[model samples]
Target: MQFSGFFSAAMMMIVLSPSLQSFPPAEAIRSSHLDSYIRLPSFQVSTSPDSQDDRFSFRKAFEFRNANECGFADHETTGVCDPTLVHVAITLDVQYLRGSIAAVHSILQHSLCPENVFFHFLVSETDMETLVRSTFPQLKFKVYYFDPEIVRNLISSSVRQALEQPLNYARNYLADLLEPCVRRVIYLDSDLVFVDNISKLWSTNLRSRTIGAPEYCHANFTKYFTNSFWSDDRFSGTFRGRKPCYFNTGVMVIDLVRWRRAGFTRRIE
Candidate 1:
């Protein structure tokens, strides 16, 4: 499976191609019950005295009925070990909460087996969980808190302040954060909205590769490094025998089993 997206300063539109492998027909969730499954909860945020009054606000609920053209595991019986369940991981924070909600809505709207798709949300704050639950009442998801101290020292200064956030590097530790039963997962950025079934991307064959993404070999890779890095043979020689290419980390399919076995998280740090 391949996804193409055009990037610019303002907006980006991504078009994804379907997979060759076909799946069995799915039973659609009745439209009549859609309201019950997606009712947004009314709740109050517990804020400190000094916190802003508008620190947390309500979000409108969204419901998407499956077209029932594809097969899916029974939501009642499908556990984390179920092979049919499509696992997806995403990071959530105050800055991108709105975009994340829209992204989830887009995914459910386009997925053939919306019931079988489970979300693993990585978050730094605990309050976001209540907000997510209220927004998507029937969503099958779990939240994991990422400790900022783990990567505080490893993170280098970046040009953008947002890039310096600890949550930005949470994806690097998915191998450790997720359960052992989860063999693979699709990691998506909060900004993107899926126009096609993500199951196609889930069915992708990684072959011997532990990770798969759109590679950009045409870009000038040297600009990513400092002049001193190129001057030192020790740093520049890391790519000696390989043809390396830059790939966006925002959207990727990662083989967690291979990642764990290889100790990739530690190596990245």
Candidate 2:
């Protein structure tokens, strides 16, 4: 299904989610119960890196609840597929674990219905899961391992070596990585801190579009490519009849349903 709305920003990526609704009060919801959770199918990994030995420790965040007007909070455990839950995805690796944790904390601190938010963490390492569990004991989240080999051959040299990391491309595969039940998700970079209720942003209507983000229509989009790319119509023809705008992939509202239907992961690979 296509979402409705236009979000304008100089640099941002846009995406989608399920319809919105009022959830029950936060006081009735308890994090201790862990009965049913949707398990993510594992990706085939070709290599085994050394185990994480010195994982960072974080203080558990104060659990935030929904206001009385909010509905859908249940005494039983909330499943990942709950229509009232807001789905958000973020990549986790040793290099950005601290920032990810901080970002999660910031989101919880500012959300009107923190307990209604579900996090889908993408990771290249297996050990980060334990670390995240300890840090956010009450957090409703799941970790999905993304094999680096999936993008190893697809990467080319870049001006900054950090941009070439395999995990950096993890967002491109969200349609393939997350559960089929999860129709839409917000993909976030570790560097952002939210000052407003995320549900406000989550409530965005993408109209008939597959994604939504802050658009930078004024930037010099051509400077992102090499001279040879512009010289060949075969290489640059992809933008033939359209106006290309630069967007910051850091924050995006992605409609996974549309993304999968469009075969975006295969296209990116």
Name the best candidate (by TM-score): 1
Candidate 1, residue 225: how far the Cα is off, in Å: 8.1
Each candidate's root-mean-square deviation in Å?
10.1, 11.8
Per-residue CA lDDT of candidate 1, range 1-269, in tens?
33344321112233222441242111111112222234443654434436545344445566655556655456667566678778999988765654576678878888887877889999988887887787778788899999999988877642234467789899999989988999999998776678778887788798898987765656554655667767778877886767775677878899999999999998999
lDDT tens digits by residue: candidate 2, 70-132: 776662464887888889999887555545766788788888788889999998888777667
lDDT of 2: 0.68
* CA lDDT for candidate 1: 0.71
Superposition TM-score, candidate 1 onto the true structure: 0.74
